[model samples]
Target: MRSIISFLTMIMLSGCGDGVTLYPAKGTILLENGNPVTQGTIECESVDNPKKLNASASIQKDGSFELETMGNKGIVAGRHKVTLIGPAGNSDLPLNKQPKPQFNTKYRSYDTSDLTITISPNATNNLNLKVVPAK
Candidate 1:
């Protein structure tokens, strides 16, 4: 009935119009020297809401990655500051330990990383980004 349809529409709109939307994004990560980065996690913090949202993905053996925002499929739609935390080849470390990152510390934070990305809604978001050894 029209009444039922209207109610359902209202429910859907309310959930989706909260000003945050995610978009599928995947890419390959290479080192500043042009080598494929074989292992590590790529994190993209939503410049719009850094304290609460982050999208991350693990680098595959071939260096390709598929990002997920807050465990959902895709990255948050907006500008983001990216960070590479590195060479974790595998998640084999104990909960209390972390693999040593090959890159320097300066590349780990938004303020320090010179890397940034912009993601728009409803677009094919496949993009590649390179990480450099911290200076």
Candidate 2:
């Protein structure tokens, strides 16, 4: 009985991922001044679907990033809203005690951010995102 239960669990776990297709995506983030944003996270949420399809990645020191979707190395091909988040001030501090983001807050929200991108199928999508700096 235990072995049968384990087999059933494995079958269920294997089917957890939906059948959404993903395309390879890579990109860089820079400020409007053309300087790379040193450290942050970037997320792209699908605007064409209501299924919460999204991809995200960490911005490297040189501002380069490769997006991943649910552990897959790409995003679903479609229009997506982009949002960026700066690194935390200090890891030792609590959330409230940490300093606010050094970049403009507008880039942190999908609704408020003007950034958008369209990912195409059968191609490696290379994106270049630029946003305003903090005042």
Candidate 3:
């Protein structure tokens, strides 16, 4: 029926939106001691978006990452405030349960991290970020 066909069309187009272009973003995160962060996530909150849309990428063992926004393959173009979440600590637990050391506290929050980057279209957004090691 016509109604059934129309419903199927809408569903197919739901994932498509205002045609906003996203730029590819990739990076590596390092500690001041020149070591790579082994695990966790890196988030980039769009500073110019009222909706506060963010792009995030999981930190790989080599400290490398690639950003994705809302299930897409890239990030929205703009200035972004970067925050890093290191592996959770289980130090209080049994010795075997303790996690590898995390990054400095200041890099865990956007307000205190003091890390920002501008993402531009048609340009390679490869970045290298360094944080202080946990004390």
Best by lDDT: 3
Best by TM-score: 3
Clashing pairs in 1: none
Q: State the lDDT of candidate 1 residue by residue for 3-115, as single tens digits.
A: 99999999766633456677889988777787777777888887876455788998886779998865667877788888888754346867557656656676677788887
What is the TM-score ranking, best to worst? Answer: 3, 2, 1
Q: Residue by residue across 59-78, what tens digits does model 2's lDDT show?
A: 88888999998777888888
Query: In angstroms, what RMSD does candidate 2 have relative to the true structure?
Result: 3.4
Query: In model 1, which regions exceed 4 Å deviation?
Result: 1-19, 50-52, 88-104
Local distance difference test, each candidate: 0.76, 0.84, 0.85
| lDDT for position 121 in model 1 | 82
Off by over 4 Å in 3: 1-16, 88-96
Instruction: Evaluate model 1: give its TM-score.
Output: 0.69
Worst 10 residues of 1 by lDDT: 11-20
Residue 62 CA error for candidate 3 (Å)?
0.5
Cα displacement (Å) at residue 129, model 1: 0.9
Worst 10 residues of 3 by lDDT: 11-20
Q: What is the per-residue lDDT of model 3 for residues 7-71, given as tens digits with 9 covering 90 to 100?
A: 99997666425666788999999988889988989999999866677899899999999999877
Between prediction 2 and prediction 3, which has the larger TM-score? 3
Question: What lDDT is obtained when candidate 3 is compared to the true structure?
Answer: 0.85
